[model samples]
Target: MVAWYDPGVLAKTGLKSLLSETIGRQADRRLLDAVARPQPLAFDYSEDGDGKAREELWLDYVSDLGDGWDSTYAVASAVMAPTLEVRDATGQVHHTEGGDVLVFGGDEVYPTASVEEYQARTVVPYEDALNDRRHRPHLFAVPGNHDWYDGLVSFTRLFCQGRRSRGWQTRQQRSYFALKLPHGWWLLGTDMQLESDLDASQVEFFRKVAAQMGSDDRVILCNAEPAWIKQQVKPHAGRGFLDNNIDFLEQRILGKRVSVFLAGDLHHYRRHENTEGRQKIVAGGGGAFLHPTHLPRVDTRPDGFVLKECFPSQKTSRELTWRNLLFPAINPWFAAFMGFVYALLGWGVAANLNEGAVSAPPLREVLSAALQSTGSLLVAAGTLLGAIAFADDRRGKAWQKVSGGVHGAAHLVVALLLTWGVSSVAAPLASELQWSLRRDFLSGLLLFGGGALVGPLVVGVYLLLSLNVFSCHPNEAFSSLAIPDWKNFLRLHFDKDGELTVYPVGLRRVPRRWQHGHSPEEPVWVPDPRDHRATPPALIEPPVVIGRSKAPPLTLGTGQLAPALVTQDEQPPAGPV
Candidate 1:
């Protein structure tokens, strides 16, 4: 089943490769980031009724919902369907029907991100959600690694194309937006192409926007991934590259400090409130499988860095070795090598078979399949090896060598382990076959096949969580292994006094018949602290924490906006979310 040559498996490889090959790595980025300046994306707020409606801005946020599954989409829709009486900016708790704006933090689809994938995975589902909607909200999105797989060609078409979607449209022109919310809050969503660095256009656009920040202004930043989690594993914290950028953007670019930082690549509920009272939330659990919340070891925050992650916690998948990534070329080579050698053993058994000619034919087919695999194997191995050999090593960093060595060892270990695991199981299963060559050959075939698959399975899964492949998250029941977790998303209410509050909603549990059914029932959603309970190991202790002021707001200058997004009378949104 793990055979890397299968179409499904090969498709998996293509998806990962497309992320690095397309989008940010190509000319599209140069033109888009350089030529495409910020457009008129801001919306104007208006008042409506007297009782259930004092006009206020409210946002419905969901992330990583690009999976082509129906049930999870249903759950995401449910998270926003019910009209709730939310406290307005005036602190008046009134019933709010429908959403004023809808924001997808990043990752709009999966499977080698393309317009087609977005059409089917996001737009169609969103269309269905609107068809079932009590009120329609303007849809806006930022490109995740998956969305960039096609180099923002598809992303720009859907989001930047007149800022409209399936009849729902907004003025948000670029992949990023500086949305003017009520009060003094700003929604700063950037393209974050692989979190490489802020592009020239982005830097210039935000700098101008940042120049406008007033002393009372605050911001809600939508990040594409939870790069900090990876930092927990390696202390450099992505060598502080990502952290430095966040600080630079909030302090240098936005001018106003970030009150809330939101991301959704993890596909689970992880909220961290730093000592400074900034809310770092991960609510990716829109669909797809769920990732683990905790690792084998407990992570302790540095002094004065009191970080707390949200609930429904569990351990992350630790089966993958970093070595698996480097040994891609060698995987098939080793598999073919073992297959050929073992096929010989099968041959000898046939030549000296105590049984008749009937057993010889089956044994021959077994060897034939293996020998056939060798040709493809050799070609793949040679091609990959050649690429590696020629890979520009001028950047020859120390991490590359160490990482390469581990991959070499891990590939071998995974192959050998899989061979042994399959051999042990198959050996007895075929024991009653009169000790014929056919029995031994069949057993050997399984051993090789199983061994070959382990490398991709382990490596692919890590890529899914790390790079957010398939726009899917981890599964709590099986984690990267299997099974989907409860669907979830965030809803934020903005008030007049520069205060923002976020409420998390989730299904009680994922539907049992979800995968097979046509339209799964929209599961009932419960609020946090009661909606779910994770295992002992969690990302942080208090996942859904409330706000508290850490320090006084700084005095900053007012920004002059591009003529496109904001109206002449446009004002910034209030507070931090």
Candidate 2:
């Protein structure tokens, strides 16, 4: 099963209480200042008109306030996975304030978010932390893609309010909300409107509320996806409003009064200084899978932002260092180990088949049993690795490839080993049956002929099936004869030059761009594309010209080739002349 957790939820649950309590009042105040300090007057100016000016003013007013001033305030946002601690300018560790607004940036449930899905993937780990009172922060959530898997109604019902309160009013429960925090910090939550059109009502509600807010009050906009960040960093053509919401606030509403714009969805934490103008913060690194580490190759321009890492103050707090070594649970090294095990099994099967020694039971039966067991084990391991890969589809590709390749190779080896053993035993078994039927001359003749033909046919079919050349279909007259051990008949042969030269089992097609030789000096065969649709273009062979005389046939081996016999002029004879 795939496992995941929200670090933001855990932090709210009080897992860092040891650090929180230790950081005390002084450290707490410092942390608030670090995050909420008022911007310089020059930095507060908006490029837009009065509306932008007013928004900047509002943000500035909020930043100037002390923590004790806010009452009944809400900071609804999503994807806030906090680390264990936040350190201040003095290197003091201060635990995150559990009482602050905890917004769940969309994708509360990953892959697909159903009620049961969330219960299994999200709620289990969140509840574990909450049960310990390690997280008590007020949670306000906005539904992302996964939450809509079973429809937004279920998500709103479970998260916005209890299930017992089912109705149209409650259906929109979690999608939108207004939080009034202590000291007048106002947080507004909105569901990610993934549809092409926005809800007219929600837009009007936002416009009306912002108009009523004073220049001194703080208003933080929260959504699952960062509409503003995407606009500034990676602009989508013709999608103005999606990114223009921030500009609207700056130009149409607050002017230069807004304080901060916070969001979560990227699955990583970044603090971008709108030092050019506004403050945009993305706190997405909350217990979900980390984002892809591969940065864009053509990063000529600066990303237009800076990032800061915050942790609790160690001096003030009791230095609560959490050992989360077990959180991710699976590691790349584990996958490599599984691969090694698969290789060992393949080597063993090959060794047994080559030895050809049968003791108590028939060699065919023993080999069959061993191959079957190994194949089963590999299948199970592949399933497990696939699950992990599905959890984080980005990084999981390598793991899936390794595991699948091993399983595929194992199946082929086992099938071939069993086929060899069966072929060896078939002749003796057929001879015994022929002897038993000798009294009836015609019956004996039929028996002997049938045995001779059937023995090789069985081996041939087995070989075909092992290499995946023959289809394994269902509910047909030939279903009983389906070869499950076909994987064994396939042989993957590598050339001496360390290139895969041949696959002599099911499919005989070579992979694209690969050739038979290690170096350019060796002879290479190029398959004509027109002759076979599956054949790939081959490598250029070394020159065979004999200076106007015909070149002799070349002798080829696994790695090296021998030169043809030549006359005094160092030229091969022309047509034996």
Candidate 3:
């Protein structure tokens, strides 16, 4: 359904992105703060007088969502945590359950991350789902890139304001917050940056959070995206932004370790146990296009971390192919016709095999064909590249323009040569086609249109990847695609004994249409007895190995945020963790 060259999904709403950049963000933040009046909560895990307030700690997490489509409905249903009867291998019937805390990892919507978009896309659907529920859990969230596109101003009003939108409310004073779970456990989430680090204020906030923890405290850390999976897939792992942050938090801030890591950027479910004995999981399938879980790896590239488990496993054979173009609403901002355009353009890039000796059109026709094929993709990639170069230009001198020009020329030359070489190699075969095939206009189109993807797909895909190495975001090397598969999430429970049991629920079936609102399909209890990634045995589990996070008890002051947190139009502030 998704290919590097088939149909390019262009990111739109450039005007909104521009407005947010120039003036809209400040105005939005000011308006939201004045009208909504958010007061973020700051709670400490160690401060829980007694851990027995609740028998079990229940929480449901979903991330990278907010597209209003069938898939979105499916995800909303998945969040409902409906009762499902599944027969175990031994033929015993069992039902999986849900949690008391419902959290969203981020990316609540797409295309123009403004306030108007969230009320309908981010808040309404979930509100409907929650209202539809018999039991509703308290909701909390961390900001993802799409959410931050408007500088998190609207997200603040929509979710962070003291008042609740629907039933969802954010109590955290800042974008990042900490939740004290049962059994000396903590859940920490951050408002993250791309290719950047936490600002000094955020670091100080978390440091105070760290000061409150006893040395033996356990933490379940959450971030905006499931970056670890791409650690090996991309040339750089989250541009080392997340890893540095995590290291700083554990080593510098807390002087301790994290028990688990959860994130949702890639839109699928996977569980990996890192060499450090921590369970890193990706559960972004909260109502968005499903990204393929597996990717091709060059033989020479040594494998990165091995995934302990994944829903839609290797047996499922999920792939990124052109057939996905048929799915409507996959690209909400771009028209489906654009896919055909990308496809035709790819074919055009290779169509020139008949430009000379064969009965092909003139130079004008070839140029026309090539231009049509690459027009949109080139503009998109060029716009992104131009922004980056301009950023560089601002930091230095006019020389950045010269450097950019030389780089462009070199890349253009290489791209043209590769295209020509591939075309030349295939031209010999093109010359021998049957006259019936050659003369039939419809037949010729049917035969050659597919290759049009190679035009922009080739030059643009490679360029997008090459350019990504220099920074992050808008890199094809880091893009994902959709698939028709089960969406999933993680539900964690902490019992009286302080042992944790993680139930990874997979919604195997997505109904095509439903009259009554969709509910969660049957959930599977991922079986892993000895693995720390899953639930350990209740009675036989090893004792919690954490050290006291802090001294006997520290009399912490008020919340770290002064008047408020995140007031400025955000800049990419760099700090470790």
Question: Quick one: best lDDT, which candidate?
Answer: 1
Ordering by lDDT: 1, 3, 2
Total backbone collisions for each predicted model? 30, 72, 31
Judge candidate 1 at residue 259 and give its lDDT: 78
- CA deviation > 4 Å runs, candidate 2: 1-91, 132-137, 162-174, 182-184, 195-197, 232-257, 293-577
lDDT over C-alpha atoms for residue 286 of model 2: 38
State the weakest 10-residue window (summed lDDT) of model 1: 534-543
What would the TM-scores of all predictions be?
0.65, 0.38, 0.62
Every model: Cα RMSD to truth: 10.2, 30.5, 10.4
* C-alpha-based local distance difference test score of model 2: 0.34
lDDT of every model, 2 decimals: 0.52, 0.34, 0.51
Q: How many angstroms is residue 93 displaced in model 2 relative to the true structure, after the best TM-score fit?
A: 2.7
Q: Please provide, for model 3 over 1-577, each residue's C-alpha lDDT reduced to its tens digit, 9 standing for 90 to 100.
A: 2222223323344445555556633443433432344333355332234643655566778787666444555556556544433342254444445566777887777644677777666666666655635466667888777776677777766666545655355565556678877767888887654333454456566777666666667778888865454444554223442325444554445443466778887767776664545567787777666655445431122323456665555445233333333323333223233334333333455554444534434444444545666653474356346534633332134535554555444434433443344444444453466444442232234333332333334333333333333332222322333443456666666776776666665555444444443343222222223332322111111111222233222222211222232346622244311
* Top TM-score hit: 1
TM-score of 3: 0.62
> Compared with the true structure, what per-residue lDDT tens digits does model 2 show for residues 283-316?
4433343322112211222434443221111121
Q: How do the residues 21-110 of candidate 1 rate in per-residue lDDT, one tens digit apiece?
A: 654455646345456554753443323334333335678788877664543555444544547543422444544444677888887776
